[model samples]
Target: MNEREEDLRVPLISFLLCLCVLIGGIFLFLYLFVPNLSEPWFPPIALILIGFPWLLWVLTYIYTCIKRCFGVSRNNTDSNRQISRRASTMANSRMARNASTTNGSNNAKEKQAQLGSASLNSSHCSKSEDPSITSSQEIEMPLTTSAPS
Candidate 1:
């Protein structure tokens, strides 16, 4: 299984176990505590109704956790894509600058231009100040139906 699918497996199993425990406890409680109320079906039926909300809560929790994993990966992917676009743009700009500089060198008493193209090429190709810094910005968003688009 992939990461998101793996993420759900443990939670789902735990939820099932919890539901079983809850239902078992409800029947146990009715058997022991509710003395003289002897109905064969009422105990199981009561357990089903009472344990339903707990089951729903567990299911919701599992779903939210799985969604959060996807959410984080998606944000990272979008940021990485944006950074790659910028890098490509910068590289193309520098290449155009270099090509123009090479072609314009034949004029008599030609002087190298600082701001024209050469300087821009040098500036962009220079080593980064911090190599470990990622271009992606992380923003916290609520993981719910009511979250902003």
Candidate 2:
């Protein structure tokens, strides 16, 4: 097949072989120790030190290889970039909506996309010392209330 597929397959197969060797080594070590018939030097200390992180390294290698096989090359770097992009998009939309609402006109919104992109500045934010509000502006209300017959 292709070189890319070949590259992935090679590492995956190598890791699988390493994993098999790890399993066999563990079983053999346990079997030898459980019997207690072997000499003190039967299981070496070098093996113990190497064994500590060997499985973890092999598993990671195999995981990367399999992921490459499936064409999922995404990593933490891409994740960070995607998250930042999404955050910026959300912030932009929120700003646009707030600008449109404060200005109050659908036609104006359609006409001035650039103007609709105003940021929520300090001038737009106000604090009220009074809890309740009063307005002198009068509005026309329904003169009669109707109920379904």
TM match of model 1 to true structure: 0.27
The segments of candidate 2 whose C-alpha lies over 4 angstroms from its true place after superposition are 1-41, 44-49, 75-91, 94-101, 104-149
Error of 1 at 123 (Å): 35
Q: Each candidate's lDDT (Cα)? A: 0.52, 0.49
What is candidate 1's lDDT per residue for 1-98, written digit by digit as tens? 54545687878877776777677677667777886764587577667756766787899999979987766665675565456545544554554455
lDDT of 2 by residue, 63-117 (tens): 8799777864546534643454444445555555665666677854653464323
lDDT of 1 at 1: 53
Q: State in Å the error of residue 17, model 1.
A: 20
- For model 2, where is the 10-residue window of minimal lDDT? 131-140
Off by over 4 Å in 1: 1-37, 72-149
Each candidate structure's TM-score, on Cα atoms with residue i matched to residue i, is 0.27, 0.28
Model 2 pairs whose backbones collide: none
